[model samples]
Target chain A: MLSVDIRKTLGAFQLQTAFDAPEGVTVLFGRSGSGKTSVVKSIAGLLTPASGRIALGARTLFDDGSRINVPVHKRRFGYVFQDSRLFPHLSVRDNLCYAARVSDRGGRSPDHVADLLGISHLLDRRTHALSGGEAQRVAIGRALLTEPDMLLMDEPLASLDGPRKAEILPYLEMLRKETGLSILYVTHNMAEVARLATHIVLVEEGRVVRSGAPDDLLTDPDMVRLLGIRDAGAVLSAAVTAAPEDGLSELAISGGRLFLPAVEAPVGATLRVRILAQDVILSTTRPEGMSALNILPVRVLAVRRGDGPGVIVQLQAGHDRLLARITRRSADALGIAEGTECYAVMKSVAVSQTDIAVGLQSGL
Target chain B: MTDWLGPEEWQAVLLSVKVSFWATVLSMPLGLICAMALARGRFLGRDVLNWLVHLPLVLPPVVTGYLLLLSFGRRGPVGSFLYDTFGITLAFQWTGAALAASIMAFPLMVRAMRLAIEAVDPRLEEAAATLGANRVRVFSTVTLPLILPGIIAGAVLAFAKAMGEFGATITFVSNIPGETRTIPSAIYAFLQVPGGESSALRLVAVSVVIAIGALILSEWLSRRVAKRISGA
Candidate 1:
């Protein structure tokens, strides 16, 4: 377990947060300028907090009250910066082997890490010649080769374009599955959070507003604005139950089956699908002859009114909670309230291909 | 070579090479230390140290040499102590000429090295530290290699400066045959006599060729070192 609790003041901005992240991928989800990087830096021993304590397992990394602070190199936590920060003077093989030699972790070999990161062919090349995604993979490999107790990534993919991000995400998933390395990843992008985060800590204004499993906090209606209203969505863990029939595949979700437009996943593969709140429509009565392929039977959970004409409604279909944003007039006219039964309608094409993540080998 | 240059002129040319080579080599470690301190040290008196390193460049060469004579002449305290303790004499000796040249060229070396150190990003050092290398290891492994071109540049400047050094060498160590009479001092002596212009010009041509050769060699060395360090 990696636990962090600290308080620091940088000029007028104050950082005060506390959270315990378990062994999987714990994502610090926030917007830009939300102190996500600061939190990661403190945990890596790069930024010293004014007070409070941080510990990994039984090891006390820092304790201001007792005047205990472990220096960065001795802390044994690997850090991957957004820019890669690879030593330009060193070859990719040497860069990966650098920490391994200094760290005295002879268990990890350069070839092993290179193979794991799919950078074996690029080992002899200089860091300046590698692409952005390839360089990030090399950086991650370098960090892992140190045999650190935990890994810290500060927006590792933020600098990449759409295709580059796609190129590197599978490697990250592979790392998450192959090695049981605990990761503390920071990002302002919700797509990464939905794809990789097992535990999500929502940070806003240098404070953790909420912390829990991604399934629990991501569906909360009150967090719509924090999640970016336009990008605000719900991630539902589903299994590919049937093959494509007429360019549509079926998924078994918590509530009922959802037919999406030609998901390329194999049968029995678990997928995480994100549906935007704005795309979901609510009806008290099931409408006939609708072009939409999905109409989940849901019971209203909560209604949160934003400072606008629309209201964010929480609906529970079976054990899963999903969010739907509808106009206040439509909500009032349909008499939507807590415990009210309704049908949530969604079009097959409304779920973009970019929003689907093929989860790990094991189902979510 | 001897058809145009006399035996005495040959001795002066060879002696100048010896003096300049020693001056460049002997003062390199001290130059690097000064450069490192001036570039990265945050301690008190840092600005004073910087000013002192560059003082030789600002002061007249004769003044610098006179000051050196007052402190390091044979009868001077340091000079007397060395003579009594180790039977070594510097004043009016070949070693004294080398000492004078090193001092005259020290500022140029330090300035070149310091600029190179300043160009190095401190973030790279921090990254090295994160890799578990200590402070000393980081400097040797990450910093020293990167600043090699600068060191070479500094050494070359010091060598060329020492080769051409005349005012300081004359003030500190008087012109002595086969000892203190370097190429420049030989030219000066030959020009003082009647029918000596041809000999002086011959020595002048030799000095020009040596200086150009040193410049070209230093340029090539720095480029090779830069390519190897940057892995380009």
Candidate 2:
């Protein structure tokens, strides 16, 4: 387990956050300047918090009230900065081997990490000559070669384009499945959070406002407001119940069933689907002759006022609550309120296969 | 040109080369240490230390030589201590000429090295620390290699300055034949005579050529080292 409880005051900004993350991918999700990087720095022993303690597994890395602060070199946590920060003086091969050579772990080789990160072909090239995605791969390989107890990645994909991010995501998934290394990933992208995060810690202005499973947290309307409309959504884990004759796939979520456009997963395989808030429409009654394939009976749980003249309705669909944002005028005309029955309509094509990620149970 | 320069001129040229080479070799490490301290070390009276290191650059060379003589001349405190303890003398000696040359070149060396150290990114040091390298190892591995170009540049500047040092050397260690009479002092002595103008002019040309050669060598070394580090 990696546990952090630290408090630091930098000028007017005060950071006091506490969380215990089991050995998997625990993501720190927040907007820019939200002190996520500060927390990572404190864990790496680069920044000394004013008071509190940090522990990795059985080791007490810092306890400021007791005057205990481990030096950075001995912490043994692999840190991958947003910029990749590869040493320009070294080749890709040398960069990967550097930490392993210096680390106390005896005889750890660079070839192991290179193979895991799929960077063997780029080893001999200089770091400056690599593309952005390739540089990030080399950076990941360099970090893993240290044989660290945990990996801390701070927005490693923020600098890449969409194609580059897609190119690297599968490798990250492979790393998550293959290695038993615990990872603490920080990113402002909700898609990345849904794809990689097992446990999510939502940080806002230097404080952790909420923490829970990614599936539950993504559906919360307050989280939607925090994440903004462009990226807000509900993450649902579903098991493929049947591959229907019409080439569509039937998956069972908590309270209802969803039919996606077409899924390649065999029956009984699990997939995660993200239903965007903007793509959902609500009706008081089950309407007939609608082109939308999935419509679930739901009860209005709460209504939240969103920024810029919009209303966010929280609906209890089976055991999960999903958020739908509509204009305030639409909410009033449709009478979206607490304790009202409604049908939540989501188009079949709106269920993006790219949003569907297959999670491995192995701890990362 | 060969006929114009005689055997005495050759001796002065060879002696100057030897003295300047030793002077540069002995003081280069000290220059690096002083530059590091000035650029990165934080402590009380750091500004004073910076000012003291650069004092030789602003002060008259003759005054600096006079101060060295007062402190290191025979019967002077340090000079007498050295003589009594180890039978060594500095006043009017060839070693004294080297000491004068090193002092004159020290400021130039420290300034160049300071700029180089300042150019290195401290973030790289922090990155090294995260990779399990201690402070000393980081310096040897990261800091030293990055600042090597600057160090070479500073050494070359000091060497060129040491080769041409005249006022301080003549003042601290008087013009003694074959011991303290370097190329510049010899040229000065020859110019004072009735028929020694041509020889003095020839020695001046030789000094210019040596300075230019040192500069070109430093430039090539800096480019090579920069390419290696930056991977361009």
Candidate 3:
């Protein structure tokens, strides 16, 4: 576990934040200029806190009271910047070996880390030649060679485009499975939060307003405004129940069987699929005519009316919770209230390939 | 067959090369250290030290040579101490000529190096620090390699400046033949004699060739270093 309680004043803005980072990927999720990056910098010793204490497990990294601030290099934390800060002068091989030369802790060989990140082919290439995603992977590999107690990633994928992000997501998932290293990922992207966050720390104006498991906050109606109406959604723990039929794989989610566009996994493989609130449609009563494939009977957990023309309706479908972001007029017309039964409708192909991701493998 | 340059002219050419080489080599470390301090270090008298470095460029060459003669002459305080302690004398020697050349070229070297160091992104150094490198290691592995092209440019600039150094070298060392007289000093000597235009012109051509050669070498070296660093 890593503890951070830091207060810094930058220009006119004052950043005061406190949080505990437990095991697994604890993401510092916030919008731009929300002091998320400042918090990460403080942990890396790039930015000093005015008054606070930062501790990593048994060792204390910083304490303003005691005036004990360990230098950045000795802190032994791997930091991945938003821009992959690879030494342009060095080959991929030499760049990975840099930390090993100076550090006694956890510097692994370039070949071994390259194999782990699937970047063995890129070892001889110059860093300038690699694509954005490829560079980030190499950056991750270089950080891993440092053998850090925890990884600090400050929006590692923010600079990449859609296709590039898709290419790198699998490698990130692989890291979670391959290593027991603690990661404090920083990003404002809700999609990344839904996909990668085992724990989420939401910051607003330099304050952590919410902290908990991804499942709870994702489904909470209050978080809808922060996670933008279009991006806010429920993440379902699902498993492949049947093979692809008509180029669609059937997944057994909590409410019912979900048929998605051919998941690349065998039957009984567990995954996490994000159902964007905007993709879901609410129905007052069961009607026959519909082009949509999946419609589940849901109970309205709560009604959160927004300042805008929309409303985020918290829902319960079997053992899982889902959120449907509908307009206020639609909510009134359908009379969605707490415990009110409704059918949540969605198209068979609506769940995007990027939305469906790998999660915990619970005896699958 | 032996008409390319007079024997004295040849001696001057070789002496100029020797003086310029020593000047460039001896002053390079001080130039780099001062440049690093000016670019990154924050300390008292920093502005004063910066002004002192560029003083040679601003001051007239004759005045600088006079000051060197006063302080580093055999009878002067520093010169007497050196002569008494180790029996080493910089006064009226080829070494004194090199010292004058180095003093004149110091500013150019420092300026080039400081610009390069300032252009380097500090974030890269920070990244190295996080990778478990101390300040020295970070500088050696990251900062030094990144600024190598600049260092080369500085050294080459100083060498070229030292080769052409005239007023200070002549004023301080008195242009003694085969000892302190370099190419420029030899060119001046030939111009003084009646009907000596051909000899002076020949020495002038040699100086031009050496300066042009040095420029080309610096350009080629800088390009190669950049290629190796950028890995393109």
Candidate 4:
């Protein structure tokens, strides 16, 4: 676990944040200029906080009271920046081995890391010759070869386009699952937060507004304002129950089996599916003869009204939590409130391939 | 090549190459240090140091030579100290000619190297540090290789300038046959006597060839390193 409590003054902005990253993927989620990067830089020792204590596991990395500040190199945390800062002078192979060679400690071989990141063929290529996605992958491989105690990624996928992001997301998921290394990933992308974050730290104006498991924080109606109501959603853990037929695959969730766009995972493979709040429709009674294929019996956990005409309703569906953004008039007519019984209906085609992602493996 | 010129002319050509080679080689380490300091250091007297490094470039070569003669001539403070300590002599010798050439060439060398060092991105060094490299390792692994082409360019420019150095060489070391008579001084000597224009012309041609060759070499070397860096 990495603990961070730092206060810094940059120009007119004041950054005061404190959070703990456990042995899973802890995401620092925030909009730009929110001091998310500052927090990560503080942990990497690239930026010093005015007064704070930062500890990783049993070792103290930084403490202003004790006047102890470890330099960046000795901190031994692999950092991947938003831009792929590969040495233009080195081949992909050399860049991957740079950390290992400089630290004079052998960890994974370059070939092995390249294979894991699907960059084996690019080993001999120069850094400038790589595409954006390929370069980012090589950057990740370079970081991993250090065999660091933890990995720090600051929006590693932000520079890539949609297809490119899709290319690297699976590797990121695999890295966390295979290494089980504590990763502090910083980004503002909602899909990435839903897909990769095992733990979420919502940062606003240089402060941590909330920090908790993705299931709870993502579904919390109060967090919708911070998460951007349009992108706010819930991640439901489910196992593949059947192969694709008619372009839809069946996944067994706690509430019931759900049919979504064809998921590439094999039957019995568990994954997380993100259902946007805007995509869910609430009805007090089960609607008959409807095109929507999913209807789960749920009890209203909370009804939160914003200043706009919409109301965010949090629903408890069996053992999982779901959220629906309904119009104020619809909520009034349906009498949706805490403990109100309803059925959360969702169109089968609303969830796209980007919404389905690999969740944290049990006990990892 | 020897049959094309008289023995004295050939000797002058060889002496010029020798002086310029030593001048460029000897001054490189100091040149690199000064360039890095000027490019990255923020300490006190940095501006003064920058001005001092460029003084020889703007000052009249004769005045710069006089200053060198006063400080480094035999029986002078630094010259005497070296003589008493090591029994080494530089004034009126080939070594003094190399020293004058290097002094005249210092500004060009430092400017080229400084530009190159300034062009390097500090972010790359930070990335290296985050990857477990200390300050020295970051410089050696990332900074040095990136600035190598610039260093080569500086060395070549200094070499060309040293090959053409005349005013300072004459004042500091004076002309001496087979000792300090580099091509430029030899050309002057040939022009002072009747029926010596052909020899001066031959030495001039030799200097031009050497200068052009150095430029070509620098260009090729820089391109090769750049291609390796940018992969283009």
Best by TM-score: 4
True-structure lDDT of candidate 1: 0.87
lDDT string for model 3 (B1-232, tens) is 2568878878888899999999999999999999999999999999999999999998999999999999899998999999999999997999999999999999999998887788777999999999899899899999999889889988998999999999888889898998998989988888899977888898888778878987887777666556655556
**lDDT for residue B122 in candidate 1, whole number 0-100:** 76
Ranking by DockQ: 3, 4, 2, 1
Which CAPRI level is candidate 2? medium
Residue-level lDDT of model 4, residues B41-131, one tens digit each, is 9999999999999999999999988888898898789999988999988889999999999999999999988878887878889899999
Say which docking band candidate 1 falls in. medium
Candidate 3 ranges with C-alpha deviation above 4 Å: A358-364, B1-3, B222-231
Across A116-168, the per-residue lDDT of candidate 4 in tens digits comes to: 99999998888988999999999998899888999999999999999999999
lDDT top scorer: 4
Q: By the TM-score metric, which is better: model 1 or model 2?
A: 1
Please give each candidate's TM-score: 0.94, 0.92, 0.95, 0.96
Give the CA lDDT, 0 to 100, for residue A89 in model 4.
89
User: Higher lDDT: candidate 2 or 4?
Assistant: 4
Clashing pairs in 4: none
Enumerate clash totals for all models, in the order shown: 0, 2, 0, 0
Ten consecutive residues with minimal summed lDDT in candidate 2 chain B? Answer: B223-232
Query: DockQ for each candidate?
Result: 0.51, 0.60, 0.70, 0.67
User: Candidate 3, which CAPRI tier?
Assistant: medium
Q: Which stretches of candidate 1 lie over 4 Å from their true place?
A: A359-364, B1-4, B216-232
lDDT of each: 0.87, 0.86, 0.88, 0.90
Can you write out model 2's per-residue Cα lDDT over A264-361, one digit (the tens) per residue?
Answer: 77788777787888878999989799888899999999888855788788888988777787889989998889999999999987776576775433
